[model samples]
Target: EAAVTQSPRNKVAVTGGKVTLSCNQTNNHNNMYWYRQDTGHGLRLIHYSYGAGSTEKGDIPDGYKASRPSQENFSLILELATPSQTSVYFCASGETWGVYAEQFFGPGTRLTVL
Candidate 1:
């Protein structure tokens, strides 16, 4: 099974500042993703990476960016943080990029903007 880990667990950020969230996966998966969970919007993918050194913009990539420096690590960056961007974020890893691939999720990170 894939194991994913997220750092800090919680974050508080000021407007217009930069915030970074890190993720680590131990299953040697090729596909990794970053998502945010909001009340009405549900879970939305913000960024994803196919493999090391390759990051791709997801469905909602505005105000955010992603980095995949290696196979076991992925990071999500908020360059110009805003109040509207405050939400719980999650990181996931999958063995394959398909409907049937199993995805493992890390503990959610609650981010608050003020």
Candidate 2:
């Protein structure tokens, strides 16, 4: 089975509060990522992992932390969130970064920070 899933599909956070979004992939892919979608910026990467216990900062890593406890699990944490962080977040699992690599995405998570 191939699937990517995200928890707390919808979230409302208060400014300066803590927020954590979780993701799981059953695809057993070697790559996982966290991204935020905004109107003008399109989709911006926040954090990613190559595999268990391996995390890398993405295009926009500020204000975010990522954890990869195992091959199937990845999480994004915002210790002090802000309204500017409000956006639709997505988690994806992929085999690699190339034309032949296939990626599966979790149903988007809507996060609104007030």
Candidate 3:
């Protein structure tokens, strides 16, 4: 089973400050993703990686950057935090990209930018 974990379950940042959210997985899966969930919108993908050393921008990568230094770790970086970026972020991992493949989610990190 894929197990994903995220740090700093809650965060508060000032506008223009930098923020880094970390995620780690123990499933040895090939795919990892970062997504943010807002009140009325579906989970929008920000970035994803096929494996370590590779990162791919997803549907909404505008204000975020992603890093995958190793198969077990991934991080999301916000260069300049803004109130608009405040949202619940989730990290997920899956063995495959097919619709049938279940993606495991970590306890979300709620971020608030003032």
- Model 1 C-alpha lDDT versus the unseen true structure: 0.93
Looking at model 3, residue 52 earns an lDDT score of 95
TM-score of every prediction relative to native: 0.94, 0.94, 0.94
Candidate 2 off by > 4 Å: 97-100
Per-residue lDDT over 1-114 for candidate 1, one digit per residue giving the tens place of the 0 to 100 score: 558999869999999999999999998889999999999988999999999999999999999999999999999999999999999999999866467498899998999999
Best-fitting candidate, scored by lDDT: 3
lDDT, ranked from best to worst: 3, 2, 1
lDDT of each residue in 40-112, candidate 3, tens digit only: 9989999999999999999999989999999999999999999999999999988775674788899999999
TM-score, model 1 to reference: 0.94
For 4-113, candidate 2 gives per-residue lDDT tens digits of 99999999999999999999999889899999999988889999999999999999999999999999999999999999999999999997767748778999899999
- Looking at model 3, residue 17 earns an lDDT score of 100
**Pairs that clash in candidate 1:** none
Clashing pairs in 2: none
